[model samples]
Target: MSIPVAGRRQLNERHHRAALGLFLVVVIAHWAEHVMQAIQIYALGWPIPEARGVLGLAFPWLVTSEWMHYGYALVMLAGLIMLRAGFTGRSRTWWNIALGLQFWHHVEHLLLLLQALSGTNLAGRPVPTSVVQLLIPRVELHLFYNAVVFAPMVVAMLLHRRPREAERAVMRCDCALRTA
Candidate 1:
């Protein structure tokens, strides 16, 4: 059954901590994939084309598929938007910063997907290229993007878990640690 709008409210109110925990697991898994790819390329000296991440090793298409990349971007953006209401005060501010950065990251993935679909590489490149990829390589650019987005999210979560008196007063979820 489809959840009503009130379900989102409940998610922010009662189930926010659990939801946020699940979201963090997904984010960390994605990070692991990226790190594995970097290690394969830099440390193992694998050819760029062969340096697919862990899952990509079994399904090499994952590394080359613009759709998969774009789908991940969309998922990340949606998660950020959906979980935003759980944050307040400094946590909310930091969350908003991550949301904005992830929005741009999503846009870059969208551009890449569009280019791949239309068979028109950006700047006449052989493969799909994001805007930032014009200056930095794709692997490094994605690593940077993920790092920036994750950093602020970590800050938001930390602040959320230790909110001030005013913030705690307005919070609905029991995400903050209890004081004696």
Candidate 2:
């Protein structure tokens, strides 16, 4: 589970920008899925069960699978943890905020997954539902969680790219703004 220090340093120093770019692409794409699903549900008047985002249209079963949701949550958590070592200072603070929020999201997904696997839906629903979803609807709750996590993540990336002088000095990665 522990990456060697030399290897970690190399990743941070030589490949941080490319790594972060790919990470951002993945995160943004996932966010797009949630947003599109919301659009389908709220704006287009599609039924909640029917609004399953783009992939769900092609793979209908995936829309109904708790495994898919849990897998995505796991991936998001892993990404945040793996990339965390490259951040420092204000960037690290903001990134930690996103990670903390995502931790709760992951827990909620775990609850849903466990309930689905155990043949029991939360609150006696046909499908697995999260704890918060007991109060707030799943669709809206997920959107809110994503927004909360994504906003701070975006801020972290911006701060990482344009760090203060002291932060820049400590950064091993070539990710800071280049002063010409």
TM-score winner: 1
Backbone clash pairs for candidate 1 read none
lDDT of 2 at 21: 91
Q: lDDT per residue, candidate 2, 41-121, as tens digits?
A: 989999998998888889989878888888988888987887888899999999999999999999999999999889988
Candidate 2's error at 22, in angstroms?
0.7
Candidate 2 to truth, TM = 0.94
Candidate with maximal lDDT: 1
For 1-180, candidate 1 gives per-residue lDDT tens digits of 445789989989899999999999999999999999999999999998999999999999998999999999999998999999999999999999999999999999999999999999999999989999999998899899999999999999999999999999999899999988
- C-alpha-based local distance difference test score of model 2: 0.90
Q: TM per model?
A: 0.97, 0.94
